[model samples]
Target: MLDTGCSVQGEQGDIPKEHPVLKSEKEVLEKVKLEQYQQIASARDLTDEEFSSLKEAHDTPPSERYAMGKYRLMAVYNICDTTVVTAQWVADYDNEHEKKVYRDLCVLSTSKMQDGLNYIHRMEQLSLSYSIENTFEARIPHKLDDSQYIKLKYAVDILAACGFSGPFSNDTVTAQTLNDNVNQYWELTKDKMQHTCTTLGLKMPMPKKWVFKCQLGFLNMVLHSVLGMKIGSVNTRRKMYHLKHHPKV
Candidate 1:
């Protein structure tokens, strides 16, 4: 007989009443909320400002929480990666003068790519310590240099011209130029680089592909979290739907 952890005193029909697994969704959500509160209440290191923000999130409706409170949690835990955040905020600003000012404040020198190259190198080393489950735990340098950022944004177009071949695989000198920064930053062997990329479910582009994907992923988050865009196209639900067959359209 399988030794079920449930008490033998309870009859089979009564088991669902007491079993935590069988609880209603409302009950489960309440339990989770209570546990979060307990953890926050017991935390010794939370500052007054951090506690206030967390408490505000806790009181917020499930549909209305900011970045689902993960940003605040990361901030409190000292694991927040601000590199992409700084870049995004700089890019997203509407006022040109303000954007320039913010970019100058957050990013390194515009003339030199060395700072961005160094940042990528440190991030690559940091990723070795990250597990698949807690990959975001690696604390990277939170700033970038302008030249490298522009190169990263335009790399997709360059890769497109090369018939979308893997990074550094295309023989064109221009295509190979894209990999030069990566090559300079890489301290490990080619085999180790390939292994790291494979383990992370990443392409051969190493840090470029990884960082590009991260920037795109953050944009997706903003679309869904801030703009309330769902998985399917909103155009499909309209009265006069165009390109009804293709969701990608």
Candidate 2:
């Protein structure tokens, strides 16, 4: 069974033989971090540590509600509500999109992602090291440190926005194709999001405040854990985002 004996066991901070979902989460987390590094390094110089700090925001959940490999983020933008987004539409979307995905005619539902988030919240409340937390926290990015929390981490964005909806069939999705899909979606999503932001006043994301906090958090982890440098004066506030989902997301 996919659920039987599915657990996350680790040494100090590393998990050996990670669950499949956790493996996917880790891959996406590292991938996004690396992509952020390249972009920042291209614009300016950075050290490994500096890059890690700056990479805190790139492709982050705060910046994008829906992007690559983010299943739980499908309903990122708060464009509509469940009252308007009926279950029938969601059902139609699930059936229609899955049936003929090549048309890019299918849209995502924030309600679906919300349901996932709800389940994740329940799992987390029940346990800290819950296996679900590995994938949930990875997809959510509620933390800015290396506490095994790979947030905004998954293939939902890249797969949905490009591979699943683009001009290719599932049979042709090879490594090269997936790579191409990711790049293509990255460019296209930026343009679409910018347009939406400008026209709809969707509140430009990734404020400077977030970057600073993420840097602080990462540094704090390094200090308290790695170098044992507990300067004790740093106070961090947890910023939360309420995931709003609409059927058209």
Candidate 3:
């Protein structure tokens, strides 16, 4: 009869092989099997000195929601969002838009190049280290320094105003193209947003207390007044005879 070691060994329970598990833990938790949990615990954790060094290496603040990765950068650029404005649209923006982008960029780019470079370097590290299924897989800028966090939020506000939506793929190629050209598009987005501000008679150079109101009700009234009258909807069509004869209400 073949001795199946099952009787005594199983009854006594198998001794687990030892391994070290750290407080920081490996980022790829899914790859670890359930059985490995017992083995890892059995292996014992590292010594205090070793653990201190490892913890220092991986210690992130409790508030940080997102892991550092390209997806974070993708969210920063609004590439992961459903809407991606085309490179063609970016290139062909009107002068007013261009001017606004230039203005915004001037403010953003004024930050020390050394700081910007440091942020970019960190991004590159995170991008290389992590691959996320979506932008929401990690929180952002929580892990970033103050300057980097400001830039991320500023970029989101500016890019959205210039017609780029948040991260997620409604159009992959357009998103990828924009992602590849983000640095360049920064200038373009700034310009486009500036132009929009100008069109709406917004104060320029963006003051500390600057504010914008869409006034949708007023816009809807205008549309209602003009609709079905054969007055072209284009805002800048100066040749419209009705506009010349219109009363100043």
- Candidate 1 on 194-220: residue-level lDDT in tens? 543333233554245545234333222
Off by over 4 Å in 1: 1-26, 34-117, 123-249
Residues 1-249, model 2: lDDT tens digits: 477865566553554557676789889997876564333223222344644554575555432322221221123322223342333333334333233221111222223432433554455445555546565445332333321111111122332433342211222334344445445554554445444334322344544553433433332332222212221221232222111112222
For model 1 the TM-score comes to 0.21
Instruction: Return whichever of 1 and 3 wins on TM-score.
Output: 1
Judging by lDDT against the true structure, name the best candidate.
1
Pairwise lDDT winner, candidates 1 and 2? 1
Q: Give lDDT for model 1.
A: 0.36
Cα-based RMSD of candidate 2: 26.4
Q: How well is each residue in 136-228 modelled by candidate 3, as lDDT tens digits?
A: 445443443322333334334433332333221021223233333444444445455554334434344544432221222222222222210
lDDT accuracy of residue 186 in candidate 1: 33
Model 3 C-alpha RMSD to native: 25.2
- Taking all chains together, the TM-score of candidate 2 against the true structure is 0.18
